[model samples]
Target: MNAKKEPSIWQGFKAFLMRGNVVDLAVAVVIGAAFTNIVNSVVKGLINPLVGAIGTQNLDHYSSCLSSSCKGDQGIHLMWGSVLGATLSFVITAAVVYFLMVLPMAKYLARVEARRKAREGTHEIIEVTELEVLKEIRDALIAQRGSVHDER
Candidate 1:
């Protein structure tokens, strides 16, 4: 007897790539890579020089010495500069993402949610009022009818 063959892993991967979520992720990755250059430029070109312009002249490089042999010896590794650069990059990226994308998206979503809540609130009010009116009508109908004896 002949059996149907299972699809290969590569074929499955290809199908996954074709899915909307996968495609969107791929696009986002490319965009993120492109955005990296802009953020990097801001950090390197603008922030680094601004820091350098400050009294310390490369503020990142300026650090207090703390060593065993020479209690106040300057460290060979300028670790603070690297740290400052990283911090600057983090701040810039966070600011850009917040101002450019996250804040606006949040406001838009808030507006949409508020509109939905308004619609739902109106519907709920109408439903509750109708239910109350129906209850009143039902009680009137019962009152109009003579009370029946309860059969045990």
Candidate 2:
């Protein structure tokens, strides 16, 4: 009797963690967290101050009262400035990642692919030339044998 054994939970978990994609994703997440700090700092340190020159120091404080009298712990306050600041941060992060990481990686991969194709093309040409040379050799051998038979 043949019994198929399913992987144990721990084995399955280990396999999942050992996958290349899983490790890559984990690395990306950690890098993204660190990158977020830089982006946040840029927003807070540079953008906030430049914006603060016009109004409040912090964008989070910029809001509007939906209802009358937005007093302590009361009324509907629309925090539009916070949203703007977050949006700016997201744009900056995306631009930095795209230009620095994604674009360069894509270009490098493209170059690698082009080089691989060129190598394959050269290999194919060599193969075709070899085949042609082999055919010529076979034809010459056949001619030599025919002439020898004629002399006999």
Candidate 3:
């Protein structure tokens, strides 16, 4: 009798970590973390200052008081400014990633696919033409053999 050995836990874990998607995901996470700093800096340095021209430079300070006697940590303070700041950061990040990276990559892939299809189409046309020529040659040979037999 023959038996197959099961994979050890260490081998299984190694295999999982060595997968292409796992490595790609890890890289994406690291890059995303680095990209986040850039986005945050842009928002704080540029966006906040521009918005500050209208009101406060810091969006976190902008808020509305709900309670009647509202003081420092006394009443209901709705920190809408922070929310707006976060929303802006997210928007900016998404726009940068989409325009700078995703959009260009998509366009490049599309062009490559189009070129590949064109090449395949040309090959198919050539193959069909060759087949047709072969069929004509076969018919001519057959006709010649019949004529030769008749002459005999």
Candidate 4:
């Protein structure tokens, strides 16, 4: 009787790391980290300055006191400004990734699929026409064979 040995942890780990998705995920993480700097710069350089024209240049500086007679971190403070800045950064990043990367890739893949389907449709039509022609020939051959037998 033969017994199968289970894979060791190291082998399993090696397999996991070698999978295509794991490599793709690693690349995406590195690219995302680099992309984050660009988004932060856009927010700090452009958005913050535009907002600064109306108020403070930094969003982290803006806050609201929830309690009366509060002084110097002695009361409940709502850091809505930081939240707003983070929200803006997230929106900008998502828009850039979608419009610049995801949207174009989706469109390109769709075009490729359409071309493949068109080629397959043409091949199918040819096959069906050929089948019909073969059937017609078969019927004509049977008729000719029947006429020859009648003459006998």
The candidate that wins on TM-score is 4
Q: Return whichever of 2 and 3 wins on TM-score.
A: 3
Question: What ordering of candidates by TM-score runs from best to worst?
Answer: 4, 3, 2, 1
- Residue 91 in candidate 4 has what lDDT? 100
* Each model's lDDT: 0.79, 0.96, 0.97, 0.97
RMSD after Cα superposition, model 4: 1.5
* Candidate 1 collision pairs: none
The runs of at least 3 residues in candidate 1 whose Cα sits more than 4 Å from the true structure, single-residue gaps closed, are 1-24, 55-76, 147-152
Per-residue lDDT tens digits for candidate 4, residues 1-152, read 79899999999999999999999999999999999999999999999999999999999988999988568889989999999999999999999999999999999999999999999999999999999999999999999999999999
Among all windows of 10 consecutive residues in model 2, the one with the lowest summed lDDT is 64-73
RMSD of each: 5.8, 2.2, 1.7, 1.5
Clashing pairs in 3: none
Off by over 4 Å in 4: none
Residue 48 Cα positional deviation in candidate 4, in Å, after optimal superposition: 0.3
- Measured with C-alpha atoms, the lDDT of residue 130 in candidate 2 is 100
lDDT of 2: 0.96
Candidate 4, which ten residues in sequence have the lowest lDDT sum?
67-76
lDDT of 2 by residue, 5-104 (tens): 9999999999999999999999999999999999999998999999999998799988989998889769999999989998999999999999999999
Tens digit of per-residue lDDT, candidate 1, span 22-86: 98899889988888899988876777677777644454566544553433344544457667777
Scored by lDDT, model 4 comes in at: 0.97
User: What lDDT is obtained when candidate 3 is compared to the true structure?
Assistant: 0.97
* Clash list (residue pairs), candidate 4: none
RMSD of 1: 5.8
